[model samples]
Target: MTRKSTGIPGLDSMLQNGFAFPSAILVAGEPGTGKTTLAVQSLFHGAREGEKGLYITAISEPQWLVQKFLSSFSFYDQQLVEKGMVNFIDLGPSIAKNPSDMLEIIKKKIEQYQPERIAIDPITPMTDLLQWRGETREFMHELFAFLKAFNSLVIITAEMSYDDIAHSQESYMVDGVIVLSYPEEEKVRRKFLEVLKMRGTKHTTGRQLIDITDEGLAVQAGLR
Candidate 1:
């Protein structure tokens, strides 16, 4: 199977070189666990390798603010964004008003940008579109189908803990699941990345130590 490098060597090691192509990966984690950082870093990596990347944000946060913070990471390139190698789009307002139109809007963006790598910053908001679990499942089914129609590796970020994700439908639909977490081991706070599942790949099974540095997020050689 063809794989796409995440650009983080240690992470790539854990992932068996990289994520499988044309697959959706659910990135579950709480706030400030480097969810966005990992997604953006991968996108920028693909951009350097001639793969177009599209970043779609579904939050109310200002795009400028998002870019401002992401710019601090060394892998983030203003030049790549300026040249259209990396594209950014905000679906926050539309999703806020009508959560149902998300599928169509995403399809339109993909058609317009034609990116080879796509990242849906946070997909948890769609859970509120309907009251019944059945309806949510149908929506997720359609979304996954639509996502697979194109030849792109998709990253879907969610603000949820591992336990929360274990009970969520989105976790089961995606081709891969990566969880980032912060737990108090002894007396200090540390970050971790775990590859919970990856279809057809023998990935590392345990929570691996990770660090956020000036360049970007990197998986350490230790496991927690």
Candidate 2:
């Protein structure tokens, strides 16, 4: 199976060189856990590798504000966006107005772009729209099916922690689960990544040190 590189430093090595192709990875983490950084950095990395990339944001913050913040990251390149290698689109407003349309909008966009790499940042908001558990399950099933059919390596970020992973239906729907957390050691706060599960790949398990620098998310070795 082909693997898709995350571009985050030291990450692909642990992921057995990269994520298996056409896989859906759930990036679950709390606020400021570098979820967004991982998503965008992966998209940018794929863009640099000549892959058409798309980032769909369901964040409340405006698209320009997100871009402004992303501009500070060294991995972000305006040239990639300008060249149409990496495209960013905001689905927040539409989803807020018509929550039911979220799935359709995403499906349509994916069909239109046919991007090799796609990121749906913070999928929790989209999940909020569904009032019924059955509806949510169906949505996930259809969404994943659509993505897999397209042969796209998709990353779906969610505002969730390790405690929430077991209960989240999404954790079961996706091919892999990666949790990012900030563990407090004495007076120091440290960021770590844990590969809880990955299908069809031998991945490093346990929490490994990670850093969010100007260069973007970098996964480091050592997890005790």
Candidate 3:
């Protein structure tokens, strides 16, 4: 299977070169876990490689705020954004007023941009739109089906902890699950990256130390 490089050398190595093409990857972690940074970096990298990229924000933050924060990262380029290589759009208001149309909104944007790499940063909010027990699963089924047919590398970020991952219905709906956590060791808290599950690919099994520098996320050598 063809793979899409994550643009992070260490992570690409961990994923056996990169994520499987046209796969839906769930990036679950708590707030401040660098989920957004990783997703944005991936998009920007793809943009640099001449791939059309789209970033859909489900969270209630304005686009400028997101760009402001992302400006700190060296990998983020204003030119790519201006050239329409990487587009950032919000799904917050649409999902807020017409939750039932969330899928349509996403579909419309994807159809319009025809992006090769797409990231839905923090997909957690969409869960609240589900009114019943099985609605989330059903919704995810439709979402995943759409993504598979689109034939694009997809990254869906969620606000979740290690504990929540076990019971998250969303986890079972994706092709892979990457959990990021901040674990304390020797009285110091450090960020760690772990591939909880990846289908059709052999990957590093345990948590690896990660550093979030100005350039972006890099998997460190050996756990400190």
Candidate 4:
């Protein structure tokens, strides 16, 4: 199977070179755990490598505002964005008005952008809306199945904790699950990335140390 580079310094090592192309990867983590940063960084990496990237936002933040905040990170490239290599679009309005149409809308966007690497930052809101409407299972089933229809890589970010992952519908729907956590160690909270589940990849077994630097997520080490 062809592997798609994750773009993180040591993450590819964890996934035995990279993620499987055409796979849906769930990046679950708590607030402020650098989920957006990691996703954006990977998109930028792909952009640099001649692969178009699409960033779908669920919170409906303005594109300029998103770029402004991301500008602080060294990995963020305004040039790539300007060159049309990376595109950022929002699905908040669609989810708010017609939650049921989200999957269709996303499919349309994917067809429009034709991006090789895609990121759905924080899919929690959409799932919450679906679960509230009692359509989560159907949506999840369709979403996961549709992900494999493309040759591109899909990275879906979610707001979840380590415990939530075990029972979450999103976790079970994807091809891979990478949990990011901030655990208290030695009287301080440290960031960690663990590949809890990866199909067809001999991924690293335990939590890997990571740092959220100006350049973006950097894997610091393997299992303790």
Number of the top-ranking candidate, with lDDT as the measure: 4
lDDT (CA) per prediction: 0.88, 0.89, 0.89, 0.90
lDDT per residue, candidate 1, 46-90, as tens digits? Answer: 999999999998786899999999999999999999999999899
lDDT of 4 by residue, 79-130 (tens): 9998989999999877798999999999899999999999999898888888
Best-to-worst order by lDDT is 4, 3, 2, 1
| TM-score, model 3 to reference | 0.95
Residue-level error in angstroms, candidate 4, position 223: 6.9
lDDT of 1: 0.88
Off by over 4 Å in 4: 221-224
Worst 10 residues of 2 by lDDT: 128-137
Model 3: per-residue lDDT, tens digit, 98-205?
787888888999999999999998888887666544466677888888999998989999999999997988888889999999977899999988999999999988
What clash count goes with each model? 0, 0, 0, 0
Residue lDDT tens for model 2, 1-224: 99888898898888889988889999999999999999999999999999999999887787789999999999999999999999999887888887778889999998888899999998887887775534777788888888888888899999997889989998998999999999789989999998999998888888899988889889864543
Q: In model 3, state the lDDT of residue 75.
A: 96
| Model 4 residue pairs with clashes | none
TM-score of each: 0.95, 0.95, 0.95, 0.96
Instruction: Assess the local accuracy of residue 193 in candidate 3 as a C-alpha lDDT between 0 and 100.
Output: 89
The true-structure Cα RMSD of candidate 4 reads: 1.4
Name the lDDT value of residue 183 in candidate 1: 91
User: Pairs clashing in candidate 1?
Assistant: none
Q: Candidate 2 local accuracy as lDDT?
A: 0.89
